[model samples]
Target chain A: EAGVTQFPSHSVIEKGQTVTLRCDPISGHDNLYWYRRVMGKEIKFLLHFVKESKQDESGMPNNRFLAERTGGTYSTLKVQPAELEDSGVYFCASSQDKQGRGNTIYFGEGSWLTVV
Target chain B: AQSVTQLDSQVPVFEEAPVELRCNYSSSVSVYLFWYVQYPNQGLQLLLKYLSGSTLVKGINGFEAEFNKSQTSFHLRKPSVHISDTAEYFCAVSENPSGTYKYIFGTGTRLKVLA
Candidate 1:
């Protein structure tokens, strides 16, 4: 099966500009997640969606960041007026099962964003 | 709340030598442990996980991790390392796998395999 895939593998934008990263998860996977990792930092959870609805987004850094899962097949993470701190690697992942005890999550290659 | 700690920021080992990366966690409730690896220009991939059942879990690429509940630790180990094994490894933990939950990740340890 094809794993999670992300677009615009690398992007560089000026500060205060906007950028949107997209992710297409593995087919039939309902649990889609977004995570980010600043340079030299651990990969941190950003949000999660179960189909079309967001299950939890507590990990979201701030209001400037918005995530949408239209039709629940894919997801997009937009950063408005991006800041330098926003420059990092954004990872998208998906899990086939959420009700089970041990579900494996597959990840994308990640979209590297550099805000100057 | 849950937190993970990876004491070593980087580890260097010769190819074909044994290697171990340590991971520790703290949580009020029971936790599910995981190890993920990222090769150059690649996304994070699952190395191994510890939920229930046996304390020792083996994963892809001949990687293994032992979960010690008492120590609150899950350390990744390999009998022999390859040059391709060089990458960044992350340790993460979730308070509960079922229902709504988020994972807490460590600072990560970069393994550098020498030839």
Candidate 2:
């Protein structure tokens, strides 16, 4: 079984440019989450998806940031007009479900975004 | 609201020496504790978790953490560490209420094992 996979492991864009990061969760996983770690900062939660529906999105930084999970299988986070502060490592994680004992969340090699 | 604090930003120890990384958390409700390790250019991997049962939780790579409810701490320790153990370790907590599974992570501790 493969672990969570992410695309564009590293990306560099100018300020005001747009970027999209993608994540494919493990097979049969129903819970997907997004988090990020800025330079010199702790990893912070961005949002979560339970299947196609968003379970929580309180951590989204601003209106320029948007996340979507289509068909409950994969997710994408888009940053419109990316700013210098948007530079960081974006991580995607998945779990079997919300409950149970063995439901440990697995993470992917994060996408490194650098907005100059 | 839940929060985590990793007391040390970095810890340096000689190879084959014991090491400890301190972590503390605050939560109003029952919570699940976890430790994760991130190698250079790699994703975070589970070290161990404390859902219930014993306070002493052992994890992969010969690491262990003690959960102290009275002190609100889960400090990770290793009797003897190798240079391969150098990595960033994170302490995380999630409220178990209805299994929301939303994690709150600490700043992380970078363990540098010297040869």
Candidate 3:
């Protein structure tokens, strides 16, 4: 099966602009997650989706960041009013489920978002 | 909450030499651990994980990690590494079991394999 795939390998936006990053998980996978890494920082969890429902969003950085998984197969992360600090690599991942049985997560190449 | 720390930021070793990358974690409850490798301009890939049972877990690419509960450490090691092994390695922790996928990764260690 194909691994997780992300669109728009790179994006550039100015402060106060809006940008959206897309992720397509593996077929039949029920879990989708969003994570990102800032300058010289470790990757961090942003949110998780199980099917079409959000499982956890405690890691969301702020209200300006929004994520949606409408059909449960793919996801989108939108950053509104992007700030300079938002320039970084956003990674999307997917797994079979949350039971830790098929616990391995497959990650996308990541979308590099540069907010000037 | 869970946190991971990679003791070394960078380690350089001669080709075919043994190497060890140290990782430690802090958590209030039982946790699962993982090692991931990231090549240049590539996404992170799972190397191996320790959910339960065996303390020593072997992963692909001739890498292995020993989970030491007492020290709360999971250190990655390889008897002989190749130049292709040069990459960024991250140690991650999660509160859930092996199936629950949420993970917290370390700052990462850059391993450089010299020829």
Candidate 4:
């Protein structure tokens, strides 16, 4: 089975610009998640989607960040007017199970975003 | 709320030597523990996990971790290290409550295996 895949492996944008990162999860997986890691920091959760609806979004940093899963097959995270601190690696993951207990989460290679 | 802590930021060990990466977690209820490894320019891969069965869980790539619930620790260990074992190891914890899959990760430990 193919693992989670992310597009635009690396992105560089000027401050105040908008950038959108996309992720296509493994086939037949219903649980999708987004996470980020800033410089010298641990990987932090961003949000989670179960099918077409968002299961949780408490990890969203701010209002400028928006995540959407149109048909639940894929997801997109958009950062509007990105700031310097937004520079980091964004990872996408998916799991087959909904409860997540004893289930493995497969992660993507990650999209590196650099806001200058 | 749950949190994870990796005791070592970096560790260096010679090839063929034993190594250990310490991890501790804080949680009020039951949780599932996992260890992931990130190689250079690659995504994080699952090394091992402890759900409910045995305290000693063996994972891929000749790595193993022992989960001590009393001590709230899950330390990864290897009997013999290899140059390819150099990578960043992350410890994560997720609450076992129903309808929650969010994971709390540690700062990570960098293991540098020397040749």
Winner by DockQ: 4
How far in Å is the alpha carbon of A70 misplaced in model 2? 1.1
> Could you tell me which 10 consecutive residues in candidate 4 chain A have the lowest summed lDDT?
A96-105
**How many collisions between residues are there in candidate 1?**
0
Off by over 4 Å in 4: A98-101
Evaluated at residue B67, the lDDT of candidate 4 is 93
Per model, kept true contacts as a fraction are 0.83, 0.71, 0.74, 0.77
Query: Model 2 over residues A5-86: C-alpha lDDT tens digits?
Result: 9999999999999999999999999999999999878999999999999999989999999999989999999999899999
lDDT of each: 0.91, 0.94, 0.91, 0.93
Q: Order candidates by DockQ, high to low.
A: 4, 1, 2, 3
A57-106, model 4: which lDDT tens digit per residue? 99999999999999889999999989999999999999887444476788
Over 4 Å off in model 2, which ranges?
none
TM-score of 4: 0.97
Q: Tens digit of lDDT per residue, candidate 3, span B15-105?
A: 9999999999999888889999999989899999998999999999999999999999999999999999999999999885434468999
Query: TM-scores of all models?
Result: 0.96, 0.98, 0.96, 0.97
lDDT of 4 at B84: 97
Which candidate, 2 or 4, has the higher lDDT? Answer: 2
In candidate 2, how many clashes are counted?
Answer: 0
Q: For candidate 3, what is the DockQ-based docking class?
A: medium
Of models 2 and 3, which has the larger lDDT? 2
Docking band of candidate 2: medium
CA displacement after TM-score superposition, residue B92 of candidate 2 (Å): 0.2
lDDT score at residue B72, model 4, on the 0-100 scale: 97
